[model samples]
Target: MKKYFRSGEIFIWFTGMGLGLSLIMITGLLFLIVVNGKDYFWASELVQITRTDGSKQLGEIVKEEPIPNLNLPDSLWNKGLMRMQMKIGNRDLYGFDFQWIDEREIKNTDLPKFASTIERIEFGNFYGFVKEILVDGDVKVKGEEEIAKKIGSYLDITSSIRNEIKDIEKSKIGKINYNIESLRLEIKKIEFRDKNSVKNKNEIARLESEIAKENRKYEMLKMKVDSLNLLASRYAVYCEDANGRGKTIPMINIVRVYQPNNMSFLEKLGFTLTKIREFIFDDPRESNTEGGVFPAIFGTVMMVLLMSIFTVPFGVLAALYLREYAKQGPLVRTVRIAVNNLAGVPSIVFGVFGLGFFIYFIGGTIDQLFFPERLPSPTWGTGGILWASLTLALLTMPVVIVATEEALTQIPRGMREAALALGATKWQVVRRVILPAATPGILTGLILAMARAAGEVAPLMITGVVKLAPSLPFDSYFPFFHLDRKFMHLGFHIYDVGFQSPNIEAAMPMVYTTTLLLILIVVLLNITAMIIRANLRKKYKSATF
Candidate 1:
């Protein structure tokens, strides 16, 4: 034992044990998340239950658990009794989406082959039998089998028409409105500047003419959309629950309808894949309880990239200056200490600073000078992606500076002398040799910054992040990148769904899924950085020689 202690073997064993325990804990957490969220996409077969009270329930069996504190002689807490959670998702009819029932009261339970699960636009889900397909308030197809056969293909067609209506409303009409707003702003500016001369009036007339044309186009689009909506509303699916409760859902409102009990393994697998795609690619709906999180993903990745763009060059330059050019003195030492201390400051403090300095001071000034026409109603004098990125950049820069300084320090004095002896200037030596050798180290700092930035929520919430953004920062609009736009974030989404949502139980699956996605993204980012660092390390093994 003495020998092992003296040789540090005991410490090594302890360290190894600690690392192993940490890895196990991480794996366990990931497994838990995966298990809980994966069930959200996998189509569970619908089960119909007949209770002792003669009531019938048809829905997915969410889970079952043993009774707590079971008493052998007591009927309420009987030894073998248990309870089950059922996602009886007909919220409009039931006023709730889930139920808990004592297993002892269940008389009989069986998989219902004809039971259909309808994913609707609102009111959660409908689990029942498709009784009729009605068009123009007339029965187009009646009976369960006939409706299933005829309505199968038309639902998909309805979805396409839904997309067309969305494009016409949001994309095309939205652009026209945007253009009209810009023209109005221009007119406002001209009037405010007292430049309403003949030429300006002619310009204004032209602008008004353009606005008139846009209005006419908008009216036409609105008419077309109304007609499409009318056509869509004409078709509806009449469904009945196990207990004979009936509801008519419009074809346009139904996302999908499937008989999960009848689906084969391959069909379920395909269904799972389709759901995964939608989760990754679709915009969230129902206050982010349903649909996809594509917008949040886009915002997160874009913000981190923007933060990196602002962080790397400035961080590297500051580090280089501190290590290579700045005089060694008390002031320099103080700055280094301050930089190190900055990392420990509360993140929300940075958010406050960002809100005050970036948004109010800088953005407000810009809006005043460049966008006076849009005064009071700010273009940039508010929370936005640019300010959010800069705020995070400020928050994470110290790590880069410290890491980069350490990387620069690792290069031997002999290398500097050798470069100098070969007639290389200080700048050339740094640019050519030191930078290449320190590339791996710089990337290490970057990975740390990115991981921290990616998960950060507090600063982002006050700075720019929103629960749901109306539009993404990037589009085909002029200048393409709308840095001044508020955007959604995965971290914020997690916070919202987990805590802020009205129905946390229903939001649980989404919370887990978003959390897992965030972890996956962070891991992928780190892996890419590490891979780059490894290659760079290999290439510059001997000080860029």
Candidate 2:
């Protein structure tokens, strides 16, 4: 034992155990997320259940758990009473999507061959039996197999109309709105210049005329959208619940209709893949409890990239100055200590600071100078992508500085002397020799910073992140990258959908899916950076530097 202790075998065993435990914990967490979240896309068999009172319920059985005992009698303590959670969708009728049923209340349960699930645009999902398909207010199709097969074609028609409506409302009309706002702001600018001057008054009148034209254009687009909606509504799906309660859902409103109990494994797999694709690429709906998170994904990736652009050059310069040029003394040492200590500060404090310093102070000043017309209502004087990126850049600056300093230190003392002997200036030596060799280590710091920034929620919560953004920061508009626009982040999305949402049970799947996506994004970004660093490391390792 003494020999093993001296040889460090005991510590080695301890190290190995710690590493193994860490791997297990990480693997378990990922497994839990996958298990809970993956099933959100996979269709389950619909069970038509009969209660002891003879009332009927139709839904997919979501989960089963033993009832928790709370101040129960001794006889009930070990009774093993179980409850099952059912996603009995018909939100408009029932006012809720899920129900917890006591197992004792279940009189009978069977898979209904005709039972179906309908994904919709409003009131969430509808689970029931299809009674008929309507086109032009007439029953065009009836019967299970016929409705199931023919409904898709009608849905295709309605879906195309819905897409056209969306394009008109969000794109063409949106552009007209943007132009009108700009013209209004231009009038404001002219009034600020000289409210009573002839030139200014004429300019304001011209802008007002332009606004009227834009409004006329908007009305035309709105009319077009309304017509498309009216056309789509002509096609409908009339469905009945287990108890024969009927509801008429227009085909335009219904996203999909499928009988999960009858679906083959291949069909389910294809459905799952298609649903997953939509989740990745669709705009969120139903108060962000359903639909896709493409906006959130775009915001997160864009924010991280902006943060990288902000942090790298400044951090590298500061590190180069400190490690190469600065005199080593008490002041430098104190600065180093401060930088190290900054990393330990609570992230929320940084959020508060960002709100004050970035949004109120700097942004307010910018708005005053550049966008005086949009005052009080604030164009740049608000929480936005630019301010959020800068705040995170400040937060992660210390890590980059430290990493860069370490990298600079690792270059041999003799190298600098040799460069000086060869008539190389300090800047020349740094730009040519030191920087090239230290590239990988500098990337190491950026990798760490990127990972931390990608997962950060607190600072972003107050800085620029929102539950939903009307438009992405990047668009076809002039000055395409709208840095002043607010954004949605995957980290913030998870928190919002998981803890802040009204329907926790319904949103749980969305939360888990967002979490998984966030993890994957961070991993992919880091992997890309690592690949670059590896190639750089290989090139430098082979060099004579």
- The prediction achieving the highest lDDT against the true structure is 1
Task: Evaluate residue 257 in candidate 1 and report its C-alpha lDDT on the 0 to 100 scale.
Answer: 93
lDDT agreement of model 2 with the native: 0.91
lDDT of 1 by residue, 1-545 (tens): 78878999889999999999999999999999998898779998999999999999999888898878543346555465788999999989998889998877899999978899999988878999998898889998987777767787779778888999999978999999999998899888887787658988888888889999999999999999999998888889889999999899999999999899989999999999999999999999888998999999999999999999999999999999999999999999999999999999999999999999999999999999999988889989899999999999999999999999988988888888999999999999999888988888899899999999999999998999999999999999989999999999999999999999877788889999999999999999889999999999999887643
Best by TM-score, which number?
Answer: 2
| lDDT (CA) per prediction | 0.92, 0.91
Clashing pairs in 1: none
Which pairs of residues collide in model 2?
A: none
Poorest 10 consecutive residues by lDDT, candidate 2 = 69-78
Model 2 residue-pair collision total: 0
The sequence of per-residue lDDT tens digits that candidate 2 reaches over residues 146-239 is: 9988988998898899889888888898899889878888888877778798878888888889899999988888888888888887898889
Error of model 2, residue 421, in angstroms = 1.3
Instruction: Work out candidate 2's RMSD over C-alphas.
Output: 1.5
TM-score of each: 0.97, 0.97
Model 2 lDDT, residue 490, Cα: 95
